[model samples]
Each structure stands twice: as structure tokens, then as C-alpha cells.
Target: MSTTRSTRPPRTLVHPGPSPLSQRWRAGRVLPLVAGLVALVTACPLLFVALEATQSGWDSAERLLGRPLIVTLLWHTVSLAAVVGLATLVLGFGAAWLIERTDLPAKRTWTVLAAMPLAVPEFVHGYCWVSLFPTVQGFWGAALVMTSSLYPLVFLPVAAVLRRSDASTEEVARSLGHGRAAVLWRVTLPQARPALAGGALLVTLYLLGEYGAFAMLRYTTFATAIYTQFETAFDTASASLLALVLVALALLVLLLEGRTARRGGRVVREGSTARPGRPLPLGGWTRPALAAMAALVGTALGVPVYALGYWLVRGSSTTLPSASIWALTATTLGYALTAAAVATAAAVPVALYAWRRDTRLARALERTAYLTRALPGIAVALAVVFFAIRYAQPLYQQPPLLVVGYAVLFFPLALTAVRSSLAQVPHGVEDVARSLGTAPLSVLRRVTLPLILPGLGAAFAMVALTASTELTATLLLAPTGTDTLATQFWTYTTGLAWGAAAPYAAVMTALSVPAVLLLTRRTLGGTRIPREATR
Candidate 1:
């Protein structure tokens, strides 16, 4: 007789203590409500988009969407996303392979450098390229800047997966007479398919709503057009229509990403006996491989630094009062820190709700928060403005209002970080704590939060990093007279004062480094090295 083994992962039972109904209710009630509320808050942007678009009649939408410029911009958006998406996957995957799987020189140093581009803001990347080579100001230029800045999104995930994944499958294939190349194509890539699909989705959705990079590169995408319509033309009807188009494009990307992920072959991750793939010796390929890695880092990270240095040296305005710069830096830090705290705190309830209960509603609520992530910064900013003006007039243009916007805009990111952390927690640890006559709140405070400290740290750092660099939203939602480094940088750049912008850019890059380091350490720590492999 054959015994059947279930493929499903074990369900984390939340039913602990008293009656099943009481336990389920105790586990869920407040958590579900809190998570649902968070989900609803995140959906504010989508709500605003829908309502604003409705303000335009079918005729207005027809005229707006029918415009040749609109059509061209849509095509521009799709094409750029495709190019950048493909380029990032190839570069990201190749770089991950070089750093994680190949016997590259100074692997640790290379790993940090590979993830360094993420420290540079997207707009800063564009500014660096455009300021240095003014000729780099079109589709290709935009692609180059975007690919450089965003490739880390793909690289980090792929590298993390590669670092942790078992090499036994590849070894078995190799022993079956398959070459290294075949094993990689068949075994390794399949394992990383989910990560690749997720990364592609992020890159594509970001392009759909991106304004800063394309704007700086002089590339007209739908996101930029929407910004121009809203900010420049002050035409809500037209802007809303364009935003709807962007949302549609984002949905299409989501659908495609889901489909790609679904079509992927099953990933095989065996238990603890599994071992990491050993680094393959490069042999004669070492020099060429080194050259390739150098070129990538040089273009992606080196150019930005060189450009900033050149501007600092040449710009007569580089001496812009240190007091002023410091004040702006302080202001930026304050806002970023506050937003990070708020976003992370808000995420806990949502993440906890999903963790405690695996119901459909809980899952849907968690997913709802992610939808706003696909929106452009401008769209999210506008949504905040729309709601703040209508519902909470006092919050309009207030400091707290901007914090709310940041929380809403980056909620999904925070949720992901927190949830991932919570997922790693030993199953029923919280329940076991509660079973010991501890109250739910105490168990959460003492047991749950401690277990997910790393995740919380990662979430806080990531939110702070992104919030500090955020431009489009800050420009719109900032209270009157508040100045951030991003806004100052944008101001100087727009005025052709690259010299003045250099300091802000430099400082912003510096601020991001610690956060990047923390995230890398906490979120994607190095996998354990086997004794034999190390020898």
C-alpha cells in the first residue's frame, strides 16, 4: 500500500485554548478589523483615481485618450518598461551568478558594490547621466538610467534565492552528463523564476508610474504626461484620464507577472540536508568576467559619483551655506524617520492579521495594500491631496498629511518586510506564549515583536531610505515652507544649478548607505558556508 504525502505546506494553526470558536475569535476579531482598515487606507489612491476619472464624462475621456500624444506616450511607457525590464533581468541575473555562483575576486566587496546602486535614487541616477552627457536624454538614456538604478531590485532577490537554494539538483544534472550551461538553464533558472517574475513586475509597474527619471531624461512616458497634465496644466479631468490609462497599464503588468509566475516550473527546495552550490572556478574566463562586472558597476554607480564630484568641483554655487544644507538634511531625516515609524507600525496589524488567520478575507486584505504600490508617486500624491482636501481639510498641507501619504504610498513595502519577518517566526510561538496565561497584547509585545525584530529593522530602514529619496510625492504633499533634500536637489537641477544640487545628492546617497547595509544584513544575510566548500 502506498501512503500519500501532501504537497501543501503545513497550515499554521491559530486555534489554541478554550473552544475553537473562542480561540478563532480571539485570534482574529481585532486583527482582521485592523488589517482591513489598513487595506482600505492603502486603497485610497485607487479610490481617488476612480472618483477623479469619473468626474470626466465619456466624451472627455474619449477626447483625452484619443489624443495622438496620449497614444504615443502609452507606447513609450510600454516600450521603456519592456527594454528596462529585460535589461535588468539579464544584468541582475548575470551579476548574481558572478557574485554568488562563480569564483569572482573579492566576492564580498563585489556583493556590496553590486547592491550599491540602490542607494542612489532613481532621479539622482538620471540627473547624473543627463548632467554629464547631455546627449543622454531620450528613450535609450532613460533605459540606461532606469536599468542601472533598478537592476538591484532584481539582483538582490535573485542573489538571495541563489544564496539559500540547494545545489544538489544541479549536481545531479551534471552527473547525468549535462554541462554547466544546461544545468543552469534547467535547474537554477527554474528555481529563480518566481523571484525574476516578481522583480519584473516591480520594474514594469514602476515604469508605468515613473515621472522623475523619464522627466529628467526628456523621455515622455504616460507617467510624465500625467504629471504634466496635473501639475503643469492643472487639468484634473485630463490628468485623471491619463492616470486611469496608467492604472490599466499597471494592471496589465500585474496580470502578466502573475501569469509568468504561474507558468513557471515547480521550484524544488529540499530539507536541511541540501547544500549550497559551490562557486565554480572561472579559469580563463576570469579577466573577461572581471571586466564585465567593472563596466556594469562603473556605469551604474561610478558615473553617478563621478558626476556629483565634477559638479562639486566646478560649480561656483557648491558653497551654498552649510547651515542651509544641514537644516534641509535635518528636515529630511525627521520626515523620513517619522514616516518610517508610521508605515511600519501600520503594517504590523495587517501583517499580524494575515499571519494569525489564513482566511480568504485576510489574504485579500493583505493583497489590497499592494495595489497602491503599482501607482506612480504622482498619482499617490494626488490621491492624498484629493482625500485630504475633501475629508480632512485641516490635514491639507499639514506635516502630518505628508506622513500619511508616505505611509499610504509605502505601506505595501512595509507589510512585505514585516510579514516576511513574521513568517520566519517559529509556528505557534505566539499561541504558546498566550497559552502560558499571558494576555494577547503581552504575547505580541514580548514574543511576537522580538521574534521579528530583524524584519522590523529592515522595514524601518527600507521605508526611511525610500521616503528620504522620494520626490514627486514630497513636492505635492509637503507642508508650506518645508524643504527636503530631494526638493532642494530638484530645485537646483531644474535651474541648471548642478553645482548646488551636488551636495544634496551626495548627502542623500550617504544617508542611504547605512539603510542599505542594514537591509542587506538583516533582510538578505549570507547563507552558511559548508566546511568542505570553504576548504
Candidate 2:
């Protein structure tokens, strides 16, 4: 009995090459460090907010938070966010569906017009409405203006998603005897869930942080309360408490979005060669639908344009000094350009880390970067003021500080655009370059950078436009005697100097036009990253 022959060959203990965990670890070694640094920089204002609140003492904060006014502010803020969010969602979704899924006349033109409201800031919209009708004030007025301004945020993304969605599920539902409306409600809308949620999140965050429009409408929301606390009462403690409450509200919305967003409906076998379904016939409903679109476009776009044109024509004859206008224009352009460049640059590392390295640390950093956008610009400015006064005295009241404030407030805009663009760049290209001995930095510079330039450009334009329109932060952090178009416009508008304010408003709107066109075109043209990368 050859027992030795029955013995199995010695098992070779072949070690695995590299586990997925080790590969991920090696790939992301530098990303976390860079992301952490960027997150810290973005979160600096938030840190200062916490520090300022702490320095004021917990007892003082509790006292401030306990006030009746604080409760009222909370109510107003929450109510406004809810109302505006719903309004924008309905309007955006309806408009997007009509244009994308129905035989809507002038669909291309309608799409562009629908998204143009984003060009007009909420404050500008408020001003136009108030000028036309002085009684437009309080909650309803604020909600109307905000809904109009922010609805475009929802429309753009929703429309883009609708455009790209495979229509197989919708057709299948129709073939199963479901009506067009039923198919839309049960199938199409579900597929657009992610876009709807994203757009709704933006609207909610905008409402939470809104100051100028609410203030102009005489609505006493948390942001307006915080502004008043700082401006009229010179009470930093009360303001910080209010800001903390606002931040909590924003975090609540973010949490809700995170929980719901993951349930987004995705198409099965999206790579299938199924053609998009034809637009459903509007038939008898065409005229009414067209009328509705007309009214929406008129309210959101026409009135503002008419008002600005009317004012510009009326103000052209006024003998106000041209030097101040030119100077303010120059200052606004310079500051906006600087802020856009800096913020876009700062967003690159964060976007790269979040997209390339899908880890908890990377996601946390990305979330931290967006926190500032959820806060009032005044809160961010005050934090910067506190930090500058206490630690970096020399930086206080400097142009650099003002730019830093803009960067903090607008960095998320750049991050969104850059991240979307980065997602489109194929990972295999970078991996192949790496395999061929190209350094990571060189690959980014040579391959990745060129591929994402359009996105970066869009980001720059978006940030620059927003920074130019920024009111509260600019008012707070701007150097003494520094006057941008926004500040000068605010100065005149507050004094009922309509003739004086008109020019600055016109100039500001003019400056925003190019950027707005760039952004609207990019969004409407569907500059989305591949689904695989985003997931």
C-alpha cells in the first residue's frame, strides 16, 4: 500500500497579488491628506462660528436661544423653506416634463428661457417686484421671489436628467395599458428622482441661507434676524446663536436628502440600445400648457428685464458722477475674478479626492466644503471677522479677507462643476498613464486638466457671478471705503434713490449676463458625468 503515492501534492501557498483594500489604500494615500487640508480650510469659518459661540458662554447662548424672537425666526425660516421648496419642485418638474416629454412648441427656446431665471439673483428679483408693487412684503412675497429665483436650480438638473433617461420603462408601462399620465407618474418621475432630490436640496439650502430677498420682503427669518442682531444691536453672541440654529436646520435638510437620495430609481440595463420614446402628444391640452409656460416665463424673466430696462433708460439722464460707477464696476470685477479663481483652485483637490477615492474621509471632506453654502454669508463674514480680529489682526479689513469670505461662501459651486467634469474623465486613461511610468501629478496636468477645462470654466463663471451679487458678506467684510456694484446698489436702494441705484443694478446684471449664459448653456446642454463614475 503505497501510502506515499496516496499523499496529495504539497499545496503551494500562493499569496494573492494585492487585495482590493490594499489597492484602494495605495491609490488614495495622498488624496485623504489633500482632501483633509482642503476641508479644514473650507471649515475654518465654521470652526470660528463654534469658537465665537463658545467664547460667548453656554449660558449666554441659552438665554439668546430662549428668546421669543428666536422662536419666531425659526418658524419663519422653516415655513419659508418648506413653502419655497415645494413651489420650486412643482414648477420645475412640471416645466421640465412639458418641455422634455411632451410635444411642447419651441421646446429648445422654452428650455433656455426656463433656466434663465438663475441669472437674476433673489435680491434683484425682490427689488424688481417691490418696485412694481410696494405691498409685496412678508412671507408670501418672500416665498414668491425665492421660488422664482431658485426654481431654475431644479429645472436645469431635472430637465437634464429627463433628457438623458432611457424611456424603456415608460414605454413598457404604456404597453401594459397604463395611460400616459400613469406611466409618467409611476415610471418617468421615479427615474428622475435623483435629479428632483438634488434640485430640492439646492432650493432648501438657498432658502436657509437667503438674506437679501427675505430682508427686502420684511420677512423675519433666521438669516435676517442674524443680520439685524449683528448690524443694529452689534450683538455677536445672539447672532452666533441664531446662526447655529440655522446651521442645524441646514444639517437636518442635508440628512434628509442623504437618506432619501440613495433610493433613486435607476434604469435596468441602461446600456441597452433602446431608443428614447417619442414625445407624448399634448393634443387638446396644448393651448393651456403654452399659456402656463408663458406666464411662468413672464413672471420669472420678463418683469425683471423690463424693470431693469425701464430703470436704465430713466437713470441715463441722471447727473450722478460717472467716476463712482466706473470705480465700483472695476472693483466688483476685480474682486469677483479673484474670488472665482481662488475658489475654483481650492475646489480642485476636494473634487478630485471625492471622485477618485470613494471613502468615508473623502465624503466627509466634501460635505464639510458644502456646509458654508448652507450658512448665511453674514455668518461666514462674522466668523472671518472674529478669526481675523483674534488671531490674524493684520488680515482684518483687508481685501484678502473679503476674497477669502467669498471663496468660503462660493466654493461649493465650483466643487459641484469641477466634480461633475472630473467624473467624465475615464479612470482607465489615468491608470494606463500611471502604468507607463507617468507620475500622478503629470497625468493630472496633461490628461485630466485638459478634459475638464470646460467644467472649470463653467465653475469660474458661476462663482464669479455669485460673488459679484453677494450682498451680506460683501457689506460686512469689504475694506473701508471699498464699494462694489452690490454695495453701491444697496446704498442707493435703501435710501429710495431709485435713479442712483438703477445704474449699479444695471451694471451688475450686465456683468452677470455672460456668466449666466455660460452656465445655462452648460447645464442645458447636459454636462453630466457618466452614471458609473457618479455612483
Candidate 3:
């Protein structure tokens, strides 16, 4: 509230409406409300799963879940995720250390190479391995492909933390008679626990919901089973029950991640007082270090390039009509760009709500959005179909429905990018602008948005790349007669036309490379990856 202040009007002040502060507070309340709505929208899949399970009755669920195949799938999913997460931790942390802490050669080139695996789509990684080596199938093959592709999720975060972290703690430990190895183990690793945990959560959650990659490797996980039930058997009840179990598994993992991160603790220091110590010189160990980096990049990146090249050279069916390929490319780009914009727009309110008010409500809203991360793409696709058919009949199987599905499935990616960008912005900047009598909207446009533009670009690129290569949800949610690059690749691969599939995969990799570079530069350079920011 405000009142006119003038010498003549002082005797009879004119009343004004809400002040900027009051208006901001009022608007702040609405953002969380919007955030809450977004969370509810995202939860549709989880709720749909639960609803279907409940409607199916407990006895039916028990009958379906007690099968040998269910147990087998459970073991496969859990074991593979455990192994991959562990491998990713070691590989990611090692690469980050080599680049940031040790005197390694060509650190800049190595950094880019280390992150290059992500430029190749996940399914492409699987296809590359199994195509080159037919024996690469089942447990070991799935683990290899997933580990190679997902390790970068861990690597980028841990690298950023190591790059920006203060090395004074290590110096103090060394001065106190600790050996170099001891200091690194005790001080450096501990300081990086948060980054490790953040990266691990992403890897683990992804492994849980992953479908196409596992399917390509002939691995039978819950995701594959769910997809089979929906597509082949048309058993919605069985699929939902299985998805409920998956949801339970996801929530359990979330709980464990929180406890593990909290237990590990965090090392915080004043920015001005922090400094990086000199890099440790690697003498005799340099050769082995170089070899390790070489082998990693080779397996993760080289095989895919080699396989694509081989298909082009050896396979007779590699050539295709240029118009068809370009048409599919346009369709993929259109949907991906739409999803990227929608997801980024949705992220702003949730990110802003949490950033402005670090309250339980804000945090809950934020986590609610992240909870969708654990869901399989097929489950999300099914849920959208369920709701659309019932309440939004017009949107069922329409392009808009596909766009919504993409937005829902990949919203977390956008949120991570946006939230991390928001973290770099100093608190009180927006308040200062508004306090100077600038309207809230004007302040956001001129002050806040400008500050987080890098994040917006990162968010758009990340979502676009991921969405473009998406297969599981796109297969289910995309409108009739529409084929993205991923779907086209899947179509040809299933028909044993490896050469035809290779071209699509190559195109996807080409499109994704720039986005991967932008994401790496923005995320690893300054922005923080998403974690338990509320805590």
C-alpha cells in the first residue's frame, strides 16, 4: 500500500493501491501456486500408475508381480543400475581429476572428448556396440553401453566442481603432514561429494527409466516389460502395476540419494578466500593416465563413429532419397524445438519460486517436478494417453499431445539448467531493481532474464537434443504418420536394415554435437548441476 506524498497533498493524502513490495509478495504466492500446478501435471504419470494398480486389485497385482520374469527383470534393472552407477562414479571422477588436479596433456581437448559421449544418443551407443560386435548383448553389453553414455552425466558435474572448488583444503592437509595421496582422498574427494552425489543420482535415475538402449541390447528390464505389455499385449493393468513397482523403486532411490548426500556432508567456503592449488605433476604415471583416457574416449566415442563409417562404406542400402531424410529431419526439429520452448517456459516459474523463497512449499514444488525424472518414458506416454483420451479427447494422438509428452518427460532437464543458472545470480539483484521503482515484469526482463540467458540457452539446447533423439515416448505419443529421427532409426533397425538406420543415427549425432558443447561449456564453466539445492 502507498499514499501520495506531496507538500500540498500532505494534508489530504490520496490513497494508492498495493506497493511494489506488496505486489511482489502477492505475485510470489502465485508463482508457487503455478509451481504446484506444474508439479501436479507432472505427477499425472505416477498417479495414473497408482490408480491403475488400485483398480486392478491387490490379488491381480500380486499374481502379475510374483512371476519368475518379474523377479528376473528386477534383478537385471537393479544390478545393471548398481554396476553402471559405480563405474560412472569411478570413471567420471577420474577424468575430472586428471583434467583439473593433475598435470595432464591437452586438458582442454581431453575435457571436450570426455564429454563427447553425450553427443551420441543413448540408443546410438547401444547400436554401435552390438552392431560392431554381435556377441555384445545381455547384461555385460547393456552395462557397457549405458556406462559409456551416462558417465558423462557424472563427469561434467564432478569436473565443474573440481574446476571451481578451492584447493586450499588440500594444501592445509599436506602442510599438516598428510601425504599427497592422503590429502586428495581425505580433502579433495570429500569436498566433491556433493557433485558426485548429484551426478550419481542422474545416472541412476536414467538407468531406471531407460528403455530403447536396453531393448537394443536385448536386456529385459521393467521398462522393456512395461513397453511390451502396452505395445504387444495391450495389458494396461499389468503395465501400470509394473510401473507402480518402478515408481516405488524410483522413490526408494530418491530417499537413498538424499541420505547418502546428507551423510557425506558438504564443504563450503567464502568465495574470496578460496583458491586452486598448483596441479600435481604426474611423472611415471603419465603414460598410464594417457592410456586410460584414450581407452575411455575410444570405447565411448570411437566405436560409434567407426560403425557409422562402416555402414556407409559396406552396406548397400546406405543411400536414400534426400527428400525423405530431410522431411524426417524437419519433423524432428519442429517437435524438439517446441518441447524445448515449453519445458523451458515451465521451468522458469518453478525455478523462480524456489529461488525467491527457500521455504518448504517452494522446495516441495521443486522436488515434485524432479520426481517425474524417475518415471519411464513409456509410462509418461501412457499416462498422457490415458488423460487425453478421457478429458482431452481432441488432443489424443495429436501433435500437441506429443509436444506435451516431450515437455513432461524432459522437464527436469530444463529445470536443472534453469535452476543452476539461477544459482549464479546474486541474491537481491532483482529486489534492487524493483526497489528503484521499476515494475516487477520490467525488472525481470531487464535484470533477471539477462542474467540467466546462458541458462535459458543451455536449457533449450539440452532439451532439444534429448528430445530429438527420444524414442520410447515418441513412439507412443507422436501423432500418426509422424516419424522423428529416432523412430525412423528404430524402424529400420528392427527390420535389420542397419545401413538405413545408421544414416539417421549419424544425423542425430551431428545435430546433437553443438548442443552438447554448449551444455558442457555453460554447465561445467559456471552453472551448478541440480541436486538437493533446497537442503
Give the per-residue lDDT digits (tens) of candidate 3, residues 353-430: 888889998877777677787778988998999999999999997999999999999998898888887887888898
RMSD of 3: 4.1
Model 1: pairs clashing at backbone N, Cα or C within 3 Å: none
How far is each candidate from the true structure, as Cα RMSD in Å? 8.8, 6.0, 4.1
Flag clash pairs in model 2: none
The parts of candidate 1 lying over 4 Å away from their true place are: 1-24, 262-271, 317-323, 522-524, 527-535
lDDT of 3 at 421: 78
lDDT of 2 by residue, 442-523 (tens): 7789988998899899889989999999999999999998888888788767766666677777778888888867766765
lDDT of candidates 1 onward, in order: 0.81, 0.81, 0.84
178-244: candidate 1 lDDT, tens digit per residue: 9989988998898777778878877786677678888889999877878888888888778877777
Q: What TM-score would each prediction reach against the true structure? A: 0.91, 0.91, 0.93
Better of 1 and 3 by lDDT: 3
